[model samples]
Target: MNTIHTHFRLSYKIYDEAFALSQAAQCHLYLSLSQKAIRFAVVDTARNKFVVLEDYELITVFTPLQVAEQLRLIAQENALLQVQNWKLVRVAVSNQQFTLVPETLYDPVHQFDYLRLHADLNPLQHEVYTYRHSGLEAINIFAVESGVRLALQGVFENQPLQLVHQTSALIRSILHVVPRNNLRSMYAFVERSYLTLLVVGPAGLEFCNVFHYTSPEDFIYYILFVMEEQKMNPEQETITLWGDITHDSSLFNILQKYVRQIKLGKKPEDVEYSYKFHDMFDHRYFELYSLHLCE
Candidate 1:
């Protein structure tokens, strides 16, 4: 169905003016898709700020075709076509499967073989995308269903858009905020149906993986298991969390019992947000805001 869990407009005046001057102004559009919702933002690159941000949550499970129809409807509702000549159009997808490999051994020609070791591959039906982690000397290989990729392409037909796995955005965003000096720390980005856990140590990125869970118990199990696997002490190591979770969320409540140093993640300090966004939690829409930093 067409159910929207929540939607917000941060600066209508700026958005209207930006669209009206689309030909002269430099703008960037960012879209993020998760299993349960689609979120987008429009940024005025010249002003170095966000003009509009919105999200639509789905109540019914959507197939690729249905998701495409919904994406088109959302674009129409937001008058996305009114804005032209985007400085950049970046889309991040979180519903697909991904794996990490060292950059030294990465081979673009054999990408499918590398992914097949960790996930099933339908060579004819899935499209593989790779993102290089320059700092960590690793490359992230991910797959998105060709149908979904085509649907996304149709949403911005004829427009130049950079498609990337959501994990890349997550990694970029976390690195932007996480202190380099913190010898041991973990970051978790909780979405509707999945959570991504990233572990960092003095050496560098220690571990990173995504887990799907249906309940708070399942969520904490994965967190605790990761801590155990990494030899991290919950009593001392901090776990900074972002995305759809809150202090009062069941996931948070359960996590507190096992991890003493849990903290809420903050938005990237490098970007400026409008005062109109004051009502919303700072940690929310982190990946959306971080899209501006995506090269």
Candidate 2:
């Protein structure tokens, strides 16, 4: 199947050329893969800013082989001839089978068994990966099909790259920007077909889950349900949103009806961005941009 590729050049000059030649350049390549699409970014760590960003949508869900081919195509098209010295390369997968476990209760020896109990995946067929939250004393455990991991690894076999599961990246992004004093606040990272709801309270991360919705009603149902379950009053609690949603979108409009303090999330305050990024919606690429901040 042919991949539909869209490239957006924010800078007037080709940043890759300068990135390739500059010995002082601290460049990192980041990728986020989902069932339906792939998003990639190149960040100049020396400047603490993004230089190039692109999004590619597959015509249909991709098989492992197809994804590998696309990755190879991306590497070639981007002209990344010298990836050996890259500051870092990271990839995050957007799969839903993930669970968070308290740090004290987590054991590496039984990691697979613990995850299998909560997520329905064959232990033999999937590879388990864990990420620890910096601020909270909890661990995020998730799995990806072994084939998918191998395919992604094979693409960068010659280079040093790290693979991160989506749950970790999502949680990391929220932790980086979510206000610490906000005793009652909910964050919804809205995507095209799914939304990740995170509830934070005085104790810590109170609730975290991903819900798939086909309509506006379904979307609001999950949001309101989380609020109700978490004892968060919509009239007083704030709902901060990020990802592919806009103020004029139906999803946002429906959410406005029930939530009084609805606001769009901004990029992490620690990172710097070029003037070119101002043209795009700040909330649209939270995950992709947050990859730079992920440890």
Q: Which candidate should be chosen as best, given TM-score against the real structure?
A: 1
Judge candidate 1 against the unseen true structure and give its global Cα lDDT, from 0 to 1: 0.77
lDDT of each: 0.77, 0.75
Over 1-295, each residue of candidate 2 has an lDDT whose tens digit, in order, gives: 9554533222322244444435423788788877656777788887787776667665545454455555555656555533556677888877777888889998988888888877888767778888887578888888877777776676667667777767677678777776678476888888778789988777667889888889999999999998889887888888998888887889989999999998888887787766666777778778888787788
The stretch of ten residues in a row with the least summed lDDT in candidate 1 is: 5-14
Clashing pairs for predicted structure model 1, backbone only: none
